[model samples]
Target: MHGLFRFLALSAALMLGFSALASAEPRVRVETTLGSFVIELNPQRAPLTVASFLEYVKAGHYTNTVFHRVIGNFVVQGGGYDTSYVEKPTRSGIPNESGNGLSNRRGTVGLARTGEAHSGTAQFYVNLVDNAALDPQPSRWGYTVFGQVVEGMNVVDDIGAVATGNVGPFDRDAPLQPIIIKRVEVLQ
Candidate 1:
């Protein structure tokens, strides 16, 4: 009877541990000169987005990249530039996973792409408002929404509220003072 009780206790403990680990959403600590924001990535819903982001995280690709664009009502974009504002030639683009049922809402993170449907590289963005139009709908191609800010919505809002300018040739939502992603650390 004692052995059975011990076995049950062990089983219960193991179950609880596994549950915590599985439900404990993995967060990415984005350290910037401005501040640090720990953003959680949801792999269960956004597998491709989470996998792509983890790939970059493992390779340390986001270090020193600038948050190039910041539209107040849209998103604060990043993971594409150096300290001098020269953009990096990113890894080959990933496919559009926008059909994954996630919506682009305030504090949610998603990939940044060109006009092409599958042109998203290392660059990503954080929506400042509930951009429902950007979300996947029956008639439109949507930007993939992978994760939301588990913490640090304030930092995202601060980044969204920064002054922006067209530095050289690019216009529209360019940050006057560049915000650098100093590093990204994954915490599971």
Candidate 2:
């Protein structure tokens, strides 16, 4: 019965492997004034970005933050400003993970940054459409897409449709009426 033992061992190992794969991805629920949406992060593709994001979620850093930038047919960005349009202090920037094979497509969540290649911090954006321009090229770094919206994309779309202008400190593209992020919670 050596062959039978080998078969049972292989089946048990395969089951464990599948379970590990399923649990590797972590989900977070983002509660906002408009509504809530769930995002599933790809740690396998973006380890540093995912870890940093989870740390922010566990620290309640996203509570009361406003989706400061909303570009129709483009992206909705937030997680770095409060209702008053004040910038929230963030930890040092993380490395650019743009080459991780994730694309800045519609419903995908990406880490926002400045002109610097590795300047991504606490702020993030949700793509409203397939933003191929945001993807990395052979010469330059692109935005790091670490997660995607798994539910309530309608809420994201509604947020995208808000009226935006020069509100608060932002010169433009700031929502006239703040779309506040109530909180972000990590799903067990």
Predict model 2's lDDT versus the native.
Answer: 0.96
Write down the lDDT of every candidate, Cα atoms only.
Answer: 0.85, 0.96
Residue-level lDDT for 51 in candidate 2: 98
Residue by residue across 1-188, what tens digits does model 1's lDDT show?
Answer: 99999999999999999999878878899988788888888888878778888899889989998888888978898898877778876678888899887889888899888878788878889999999888767876789888888778888889989998786445867788778889999975
Clash list (residue pairs), candidate 1? none
Write the residue-wise lDDT of candidate 2 on 1-188 in tens digits. 99999999999999999998787689999999999999999999999999999999999999999999999999999999988888999999999999999999999999999999999999999999999999999999999999999999999999999999999899899999889999999987
Which candidate gets the maximum lDDT versus the true structure? 2
The alpha-carbon lDDT assigned to residue 149 of candidate 1 equals 85
Clashing pairs in 2: none
Segments in model 1 whose C-alpha atoms lie over 4 Å from true places: none
Cα misplacement distance, residue 111 of candidate 2 (Å): 0.2
